[model samples]
Target: MDRITALRARRAGIIEQMEAIVASVGENEDLTAEQQSQFDALRAEDDRVAAQLSQAEDLERRRAAAARPAAPLPGVTAPVAGQPAVPAQPAEKGLTFARMCRTIAAAGGIPHVAAQIAEANGDGGLFANQNMGSGPAGGFLVPEDVSTEVIELLRPASVVTAMGPRMVPMPNGNLTTNRRATGANFSYTGEQTDIDATGYTYGQVKLSAKKLAGIVPISNDLLRASSTAVDRMVRDDVLADAAQIQDRFFLRGSGTDFAPKGLRWQALGTPFATTHIMTMTATPDLQKVTNDLGRMELALGNANLPYTGAHWTMSPRTAMYLTNLRDGNGNLAFPEMQDGQLRRKPVHVTTEIPDNLGGGTESEIMLVLPQHVLVGEHMGIEIAMSTEAAYKDSSGTMQAAFSRDETLLRMIMQHDIGLRHLAAVSVLTGVTWGAA
Candidate 1:
């Protein structure tokens, strides 16, 4: 039999023996000393065989994918004489951020474990220059493919990205661009007569990296049972927490010293609030709600902004309200709502839009020109781990990782959001359509 088959067979036998040992004990009766030792040895053997089987399966998948011929390049009428065309690099199936985190934790948070893991997975040349030095703040730089996957996965998880804004790379951790402040005056003038001069002014739109960090405490059991499933669980949990926090700052940040100025703050800056802020004076009906959204569009349209890339942002509660609202003919007022569009523009529903603005019974709706919204990110996600550090739990109680036998995986991302034009954002406030 092949090595893989033999390992699986061995693991099955170990499981059967372990089960028999457990069955030997009566209900509510403990195992004898001899039986306990035998079970422990068999359990260890099972874990070893499982690891071997997992590695073999991963290698088989890689081999199969590699064996497939590369698809022919489109629009290639002739071949180049110098050399063969380079194939597109794929995200490696071997090294992942979660797998890297597992290595670091298993090695007691040593950063160089990343390099060791990479070398063992036939990627020695790829990570040959990884930093091997150790320091407190020093952490493993995640593989490029893994970091790219994390960014792509963040799109569906983050409303800011799901809305399809302009993504800007901030390698230097900061960016600045011109924002038009006023337009030049134009009027009829007499031929050869002295003409009044008018100059269009400009302001600055700046984006600076802000540190966002989250700690995910993983069960120690995963360390012994590492696999692709463990990787997915770690990646998903981190994505959910990271996106939720990012949406909060991207939508409602008060432009404080600690947080980036969000869409609402940008609208409340001045001219937008005066012209674009639509207030709900009464409980919304089909007509009132439709009119409110219409006025919001007009607010931007009147400013000469096109609805080509305009998008809608509201809370889940508000979306359902519109979905349930019916017209005079007893048909859906917004029939296309189920397809995630309002007025034919894409709609992004997120709980980040507060429903308790005034008197704990209000919400806000934002119509934005996505192209005018910029999300600048520095280097992607970086990971660090700690086995001896103490951190506060979700309930505000302090817990030690070493004592709990859990690993604290700390993920840090640096990114910031800004608007090239503040007028590109319009908000409707004090909405109580679906208030409880």
Candidate 2:
């Protein structure tokens, strides 16, 4: 069964045990110390289950709201000519993300408070299943609409994600897909000739959930604000921070027990890391620069890989350098830069690819087939707010939230990334294509 159903059953079992313990007591007889302790433990466990269930139900609500159509507003006027009708706003009184966070924080991270806020905003169904969504420092699920906003923000900010990689659902936190390992042998056979038994080889690609979490302390006043500007401001804050962090991991993460293996790590080892991976030479020669670009594509092309979904990625510095490259005749070296493309494919530039490789002056360029990048998503973003929690900063110094009147917002996402085919990536290291 799914987590929510299991939790519901577990909570029911705990409730039955608690009832039995209460029944063991005689009329007007107080429970023994052990009984009281057991009861308290069961109560706490129930609360935790209820909290998880509440969040799961919230996620279900968001999913339902996202899937179903919004009810039309009563007494609303018709749209103007030649203009698409504005769909009714989904949330009432502008139940913006900031407003939800403010409500939760104001309630001191109480989940029932979220239920109250949802009800007040005409969304009684948000927590109708179980209302204790916040269990201590645990967080609430981001609303579906807001979660969508996060995705919109994620694009253009996260280079890999912006390219629209293949999304695979990991509902059970694990997935395995069969990948073709070899082409089937084929040969012409006459009508009476014995047919040769040949079959395509296959391999398995596995994905498991990995947790990515981030914590930030926001000004209490920020969450407490009533203006819609606060909503946009806080959303932007999350967008900028989340984009950078996600891109960094997606680009250079060491595939360990912690973070999912990124493209850089995927490029390592095998023939790709050596021969398939190209090395760059610094020069202002227009032909030479274009030659280097050709070699990168040839690495995959020689392997019979398709070029349908190919794209280029480099640092901003590399992109600007290539954009302005000029030969002695003053003609642009790569004219496709005007169309936001390179080598006739789209380009994504991010600073996550460092320039410190090879004596600290070199950077790298990546040409990728976006379709080969697989993202296994377990769930959308989850957020928890706390007013009394203490957090450690980058310096490992503890910062007290209550002391500073700050709200600690912790966000967690569970997902993993993999390459459907490692050969789909080509990298050029020690790149000085844009260097003077």
The true-versus-predicted C-alpha distance at residue 78 of model 2, in Å, is: 13
Candidate 2 has a TM-score of 0.74
TM-score of each: 0.74, 0.74
Off by over 4 Å in 1: 1-95, 112-129, 132-138, 143-145
Cα-based lDDT at residue 105, candidate 2: 71
Native-to-model Cα distance after best TM-score fit, residue 428 in candidate 1, in Å: 0.9
**Residue-wise lDDT of candidate 1 within 1-436, one digit each (tens)?**
1555566557757888999999989999999999999999998888888998999979978988889656668985555679788798875442365666676676675444444544455444444434423347446666566677887888778887888888989999999989887899988989898889998899888998887788888888886566778877777777888888888899887777667888888867576689988887596788899899998899889888896579999999999998888988999999888999999998999999978889898999999998889999898677777878899987999999989998888888888888887889888899998887
Q: Which ten contiguous residues of candidate 2 have the minimum total lDDT?
A: 91-100
Q: Per-residue lDDT tens digits of candidate 2, residues 289-341?
A: 77888888888787678765698989988898888888888988778887789
CA lDDT of every candidate: 0.80, 0.77
